[model samples]
Target: MACAQAYAADTFVIKDIRVDGLQRTEPGTVFTYLPFRVGDQYTPELGAAAIRALFATGLFKNVSIRTTGNVITVVIEERPVIANVDFVGTKEFSKKDLVTSLKQVGLGDAQPYNQALIERAEQELKQQYLAKGYYAAQVTTTVTPLERNRVDVTFNVQEGGIAKIRALRIVGNHAFSESTLLDQFSLSTPGWLTWYTKADQYSRAKLNADLESLRSYYQDRGYLDFRIDSTQVALSPDKSSISITINVHEGAKYVVSGYELEGNYLGLDNEFRALVKLKPGDTYSAKALNDSVKAMVEKFGVYGYAFARVQPAPQIDRKTHEVSFSIQADPGRRIYVRHIDIGGNTRTSDKVIRREFRQFEDAWYDADRIKLSRDRVDRLGFFQNVQMGTQEVPGTSDEVDLDMQVKEKPTGLLGLGVGFSSANSVSFNASVSQDNIFGSGNNVSLSLDTSHYYRTIALSSTNPYFTQDGISRTLNVYYRTIRPYTSQGNNYKIVTPGVNVQFGVPFTEIDRVFFGAGFEEYSLNLAPGAPASYISYVNEFGETAHGFPLSVGWQRDSRNSALVPTDGRYQRANMDYSPFGSLRYVRATYQYQQFFPLSRFTDVAFNGEVGWAHGLNGRPLPVFKYLYAGGIGTVRGFQQSSLGPHDAQGNALGGAKMLVGDFEYQFPFPGTGVDKSIRMSTFLDSGYVWGENEPLHLADMRAAVGIGVAWISPIGPLKFSIAHPIRTRPGDQTQTFQFTVGTAF
Candidate 1:
């Protein structure tokens, strides 16, 4: 009894707790988890509990509790601050990726260093590897303590070669040939070049993916009840090679008899019935029914009923071998917006985002306004993603709040690139630009471009709201020297300085009109081999011309998102005429772009443009003012400015009138995890150019179809295309391919 009392007496009231090596964590953040307070009695049990809790925070290296007389001290050795994290042998994800993922699991800078975190991270990585079919992947993590109580972490990973689909066997597919059934799987036989292709060593992930592929394949072909029963992946003794076997069940398919509309439509029954597109004799497609319901919901939303709900009920008749769908609509009470919340903007100011909002506080919630707001934010091009949703404000029955989230992208960028084509020669361009411009709504860019035919240096700036009345202004100054490829000796240089100011006049919640004009002083020097047509225009417009290029333009863009548009039409029309000013020409151009979403990751775009530049009041069109085509933005199979008139030596003579038509089928790159960062497109471009007196000929027009890659690079969108001429004429130079930079369509 005496010994027990002595042991109990050794433990006393706690004095204080001290934390060391804390670089990112606050002391108060740690104190909340301690088991004993300053005046509370301390015991071995309590000390152990406190240590466990501290470790659970994942922030400490060592935790100890000691007592002296009636006072107790809780001493903690904080885990080293994560000074830096680095990864090697990783092309699968960017550095930002691991940082964000680790932060979510509480293992970032200033976070506790419990061994459990490291273990969890390792396991998670291995799981990801497994998902990628790296069955034998090995991952190891190491923490190296550095000076200043910080630490550097390295994830030593042996990702191993990706497992491929060596051999696939369909065990339960007796009705079909084994080979035929296996061919339906995306995972295929190991080619002789599997070292590079690596399509064959099977793993669980590949097997699962192939299972889904198989189900879809059969389902689309009338196998309504098709399913993958089970799959087995067997590995070789060395664990390097694998084989897979799948069991599937195929069942009878059904067709739709028709669709019926039920429930109240609030006097919109006929309107809602037309929204249902499913018809008799059509296959029983769940997807079709779902789409019909969603379309109806959107239709209701357009009426200011933002909280509409839609549900579809499908009825099956076994005897008749038919299916019928009944779509139900519920348009809830219309509510007004109380507030708008902006989130996920770590660097940009809220005003910058809010300025793009079309929906206002205390206004009836308009679904169109919400969509327009999202589109406007996306068009800013400052974020990789823009998402907006409504959050029902609790305790309020008549109003809801809006929350907009954005993922900021790098604003400052530097890049150097070079390209060569028959028309442009070897073109090298480099630049430095910042769109955000030091957190203000401004832009600054400097570019130095060199081509075999021309050399240019340009500086430009734009102030979004130069006069506070939303009057945006842009200033551009550039100097360029052109070396003509013409045999004639008329090569010259040009220097241009221009400024434009545009004002926005708001008309409606989602409508704005702007009118602007600019004056540019252009100094032109004639190049050699010039045609009579060209010399005549230049002689009339002359050496150094200063003109007020007056113009009025209007644009209306309605889309869900800008980078990856789901649905919208962008229309712009402008007319610029030199009336009583510098040069002698009148130019009018109009363009329309329509975006249709074929799927979540695919967009079909239709673009058309018409431009006419005619001499004003008997004055000839300026030579420099003529339109040039055949490049990234025009015909893809021809060189830059090569589509227009050409002299005997092939020097291009610009034209006064032009028309362009483009159709692009854009789809996301397979296996590229990023949805907006990259896109692959197949396009058809057709256009022609004609002089004022020259007659347009269909035989002289150009058309091409090809594939290209589009990347939303940090600098800007970079487009590279390789095309093949679809229609070739005899004696014509079949320009079969072309590559270019910037957004072409």
Candidate 2:
């Protein structure tokens, strides 16, 4: 409210100035904003301007200026500062998150409280809840005055039940059935699994994505004139359910007549024409046309044309439903890289990443080299995102700069496991690893397993840039003991201690060769209930043996991602030989894996492995060096290492020959949308281990079929499978379920 006595029509500032009704603001502060000081004459206009200026500062809610005998008096009231902002009945979003969002809207603690701002905050909070499908939520704000001209703000919310998608209908989709079209949508009616997937909730963003998918489905299948006419969403009166309807037009399909290159392709018209994927008799597909244009542009980039442009002009015949297209390409000026800039590598040294770049500064831009550099950096497994782009230099059309940016992620892994047997015995396992230790691009790991029947500890370290030529050196030391568990209570054990050093040389961008040497000492201990095979081996090998092992290996990997690859091929082969030791033998193993993309969200992967060993220098292969098959990494639905020969006590004796194969179809988990970090796969696995003297037969291989879930979680990678053995032998041991909580290659 204004003062009882208003400002006089005539104003004067001849003698002095006095400010009243100020609780926190000082009198001098008001004078600073006053247009007229005591020494200057004051008119009614100047007095009104001073009041307007003081009000603009937001420091005072009310102000009045009056004059009594050439003296000026200014009365003001200050707005209260918000002392606290609190939320009540908020369960969907954390209070901290709400506070951060409020600060962005200028309505946080210490800010002057305003009714309009409070109203906006209430509406925004309601919007946040609505985005999560909580359409019936309510929000009410209260402001309470406090001491020292402060106030407390509180938002009371009643978040009702989430609105569900009850009905979904598609109209005018002739080429595809309604059910097929609905399958492409992410939203659906409530199902048994909706409690976990939440697919039955109505989200505007998901709805929009479904619309795009519907459009693409037709356009990619030669419906050149396909279009989504309109969409309608309706909510129930109770606001607890939603229904959506989408209307679309599936136009007539068209066939390609032909394609021609009309623009200058740098005198390489034939080369550019070969890149076109649309054949003359094939159906006209938008996907194929877009792919052709993209390929042409990338081809130009390969020749240093950074600003290449490619566009397709389509000519259609409505009468015959035929289309012909002409591709126009303009190879822009050739660009030279003036500089290269690296950013967002706070945890990793610049040298560690710079060494991986094949593109050099002051050279012509090569798209292939730039792409290779980006992939190499991403393959380091230290960053979540890596991006590279060319920024044209100012005042120069032929010069550009390469900007590389990365978003670093945690490169540390912590693994833990716990299991219980039928006899109530518990086993524990753990491992700690860091791939980029201390930001030096070094790797170190320690692993331990504590089980009543088996125990082991291993430590390893690697320096990726040990020689500064992209060569890597690694050292490994380990101790292991194995005591097989059987129904007859086998009381024998084997212990081995070993050390090794290895070095890797890069043969190509995707290939590497590795060599290593190691020394291992083994000892066998027996009790009264030991297995017959173990006792016989102990007698023949004299209970203790030493081996000097040498190893050579080669690998070629072209996977798009190391942790979760959707496509690529990986092949690795390794050989180990102990030529001059008591346990002289040679062992070789080869593995091949390839992934095929079946659709945007589906892939098929096949993995095959084979191993063989034999005596060398007139000595038999070491029993400890024999290969074992079955279990999660080999054949699921079978006991670990239980597919080979057995002793008198029915304990498995690992075989000298092993073969395993796995075929899996991977897809995103239902309701996950496009998130690839979590997915599901169906697998068919078959393998068997054979004794050195036994005949190898394909019919003898054991097989199993199963389903599994793979998750790249915050802690580590996790995999769980439930399988049923389809080709089990009479004495085979089967385990229907298995899970692992670490990375698997």
Candidate 3:
């Protein structure tokens, strides 16, 4: 067929139109591409345009337009459809992912196959491999004609070796050492942890993030004018090695001259001014400045100024190298919450989250209440992320909507494992728990443990909001058997079965009071080599004893994070009274924990606990309820529960009074920068237990120094300690190393 240019000079008025060489395309479709209809004057330009438009649709491989007297003729050869798409020799990415990538770029089965699209897809595939460090990757596309005017497209890929970083150099750094600045980066040259962290792989995204970190590091240290000039990344000839060079400029350090608050503060100027953390003559810190702005804005939000804006304008003086900050505030129209929208909670019930919110619908917007609600929801441990966003209500200037977006996480835990510790040489444990059972905001757990010296089965349930006032109810039933000093031929076992109910009443945002009652039955099984204390207890109180125990407790926690607390205080005071039991006694305990962050990567923690128990109504306290302190949870330089008085057979005889104190300095694990989940600590622990009727004295206290590690692992939290006794008695039992798994310390 001749091309459309053969009749470029001809012009005519078409009385009829005809389309030829149409296999799957309709005549109407071809007519739609023509610039002239029947009875319309058709010229050389219109005929050429008709051909070009049909070809531009990518549906035709060849197009021709000609004139037959007064009738215009159009002919086109349609492109073949893609019958199938396939990939070969792809390992870096899955076949499904590759196909999806191709589809996203208009190259897939059943679509009109074009050679240009095939080439573009191949290039894109190669780029994806390059991003993953496969610098030598190769991609090629092949098209094969199939039946029914269709074709098959195949992508062949060869993924080669990964490019590793060989050297990293930072230039023009003076305010801080090169090593110090490099340590702040997440990317690095080959190292021991490179395999896990993938820090040795050169990534554009990682480099960008590292550069931002470097900028923040300088800005936070008074280098307000610091800048990253340029970054150069070079790959080796073999495409297997990479070298990075970062150029930076560290301007002169500046000190804060002063700060001024600008704009109306709604009659709370003094309150807002007090939120500023920066002071005159102090090193200018970007973090402090930003925090001040955030504080002021949040204060405005407390008064329903949801759209308030607080910005810091810095005035720099190069002569004196001093900077002053002027904070500007703009509180827009007061906002009232029109609606409280909840979203992204696929598994959790709305009630579970709504009850946690202190802010109510149709109320004035309060930033403090919304923040507290977010925190409370986070503390529930039911979601991976909780975010709050404000959206303007349509057609309303002073009304806004609060959207609480939550990403739910797995709340059900099934644990089955075997572990070894110095105390319980080997133990097998299994547990099933659901923190948000059925999305009803209730907790249920069943646990069973089988150890060499102890066996237990427990079932518990807790309703966090049993009442509208935020009162929690908990019920527990448990059975435990404990064998004391079984390795030393003391085969005595105490079996206890008990049930308890408790209620937690919220007194303040961070304080709660708990009251509970329990019924317990204890039976002693005396073997041939039972301890003397067990025999004496049986002789005095009989083989079996029952008790009705009542408990009252108070707790206050203000930690920033429940999992890894770096700042705040935790305190607890509890009392237990067995006034209606054969064993009449009273026990009281007080505990205090405080954490102080020394720097971004280090913290100091202190813990202190004291307990005392006394017999009443001429009946001795139950031996099973005695206080024992040692091992992983207390003074680590001693055997498990062995820091107290002993029976005639040298078995551990737990005491009625106990005291423990621990001081620790925790730092991040080496090579795992900024990861708080894994930490190392050097600690000093002192504790002791006194027998019944024994007077408490400081001389009897034991002390130890140790090093420990805490890691939050996939299975659970793990803690290990190695210590040496600094003060010991002749009869004291010492354990140099102890560890516990599947539990928190």
Candidate 4:
């Protein structure tokens, strides 16, 4: 009875309620948290609950509820709002990044201030530094009170030096040498190239990747039971260096006994079995097994089995040291594509992308067609990345939707450049090109080039899809003036202006045919020291000449990548005929290129080219149209345009027949394993040019061996080589080094 009286004394019926200390916070916000309102009965428990709820809002630092004569009074002290946030002494991370990180943790400006959040921010900053190998980094926070019930926050950071790797060791490596295994790791003890490659830096992510490489190396060599036992990373007492140790166990090697196929194979068991790369009595290889599985899965996907699963179950015979695999496949129900959604093309038109799609909507999902579509879009060279994903349609079991997400890259280029070459000495060039003009998938270009030997201005445009059947049309107009780089004692010049129109028709997926017609006018200027042959030609024909040139060509390309091909064949045959001109002749050229991949990072490439020009209607071939060899693109050991027949005055006279062959073994640059952007090659080059009536002979060929580097740099593509001529005559001009910059080869 005494407890009941005490509780009743603290209870009351509220007639009105009032909240105090409402700076920055509305009174209605306080009322929303109150448990009881006016005209409602309030007990001591209810009043205590209201006070707790208001404090939990984080807006108030203190809260008190009291009642006098049936009226409730709430007293609160609001927490100070953050007026500004700033950083000091931070260098490793940008200010925007820190602010964004803090905002994610509810510590930005205009938010209520709290000491706990400041501690969290400091801890996060330290963790970020630690990830970057800054073990001794420090962070401090400061809060300064300001007017209008606000405060300013500042974070000061001190980023210490990066911890480098001092030592690296491997344990229990028997089949392979320790040095050989260490060579596969990106991280290493300090070495000569560490300053540039940063290979001596200690990083958890790099360590993990190295561990995976180590595992793959063993597994690919028949070590079926290889395992990494443990890894230890230790830092020096001063936190300036780190040491890493990796322990591995290699079990017994095994050989493949046989393989079996299990599960439904869509009535193509023999086809699926033939896709296996493994053979009986061969060494066991995880890579081969994965390749066989991937091939089988893709085969199923070709038949519209979009959701297919293939698993390998290996059986081990420990006594015989043999292993067998049971490949199990479960191809789900055949799916039909309902829709294809394309996104991330902010500037390109829908038709521009849609025309490249080989897989149509409302069709059975074909993986091969989808892949072809993606490749075609990529070949347009207007996007940085193109990704495709499948989404299951809602309320449908055997239907799916495809989403193609592309990241657009700049396709318009306006460039001005200056360069130096052994042949031309100095050159200046300017160009304006738009590959995807106005997102209409049309190409337009205007260019001007000036050099010691040549000067030219050109304008060109192309429409890849001029018709619905994917035919392409191109138009080009140009005016060019050319002078011999070294003409003995003669000064001769030729000015030519031309316009051409061409059409490209696709005959097959990898083949195209082109036909074009050009109208050109040529004017010649000759000074003293001109050759007798040139004077005879001028006497026979007038100074100015006009011609109508017709061209036909065929090209077939099967390279996996257009920019850097590893395994493929490319062939081209072209012919040009001038039927109505003072110079009546026919010229033809054939070229073939073959690339064979030796491994994932190495390749052997071969190129052969042959050209011939003959006079028609008993007319002589034009001297300006003759072919010349020996340069960066021909034989690297000889001077540019210096490998042909010489005139009586010791000047270069280009030939009517040419032959060139090149063989190269290419690999990634040192310390840049598997990076295709920078490559090194050892090459053998042979080529020669013949006179108008000279017979082709292998004895006249010029051969050279060289080492070269190709780099796809940010500024442009660059190639340089140093060569030694194998056989040279007294008149042959030899150049030990040759290079080209700002060229796309």
Q: Which is the leading candidate under TM-score?
A: 2
544: Cα error in model 3, Å: 1.1
True-vs-predicted CA distance for residue 456, candidate 4, Å: 1.9
What would the C-alpha RMSD of candidate 4 be, to one decimal place? 4.9
Model 4 TM-score, all chains together: 0.85
Residue 268 Cα positional deviation in candidate 3, in Å, after optimal superposition: 4.3
TM-score of each: 0.70, 0.90, 0.83, 0.85
lDDT by residue for model 2 (589-651), tens: 999999999988999999999999997866667777888887768998887677877776677
lDDT of 3 by residue, 277-302 (tens): 99999999999999989988889999
Pairs that clash in candidate 2: none
Model 1 C-alpha lDDT per residue in residues 1-745, reported as the tens digit of each score: 0011112334666666555445556778778997767878777777667777876775666666555566555566666677776777665567688777777666776664556777887787777776666777788887899886877788877777666656678876645687776765546677655544445645556657777767766755545667878877787665566777777887667788877776668798888887776778877766666778888877776666777888888777766767777777778887889999999988788887888777899998888778878877788877878899889989877688999989987776565666555432456777777878766757788888776655778887877767654566667677766555333334555556566555555555445566767776777666665565556656766677777777777777766655666578888888887776667678888888899988666889988887788877777776667776666677777655666676666666668878888899988765453466778889998887777678877677778898988777645666677877776543223344444344211
**Count of backbone collisions in candidate 3:** 0
lDDT scores of the candidates, listed in order: 0.70, 0.86, 0.87, 0.85
Question: If ranked by TM-score, best first, what sequence of candidates would result?
Answer: 2, 4, 3, 1
Q: Could you tell which candidate, 2 or 3, scores higher by TM-score?
A: 2
**How would you encode candidate 4's per-residue C-alpha lDDT over 171-195 as one tens digit per residue?**
9999999999998898898888777
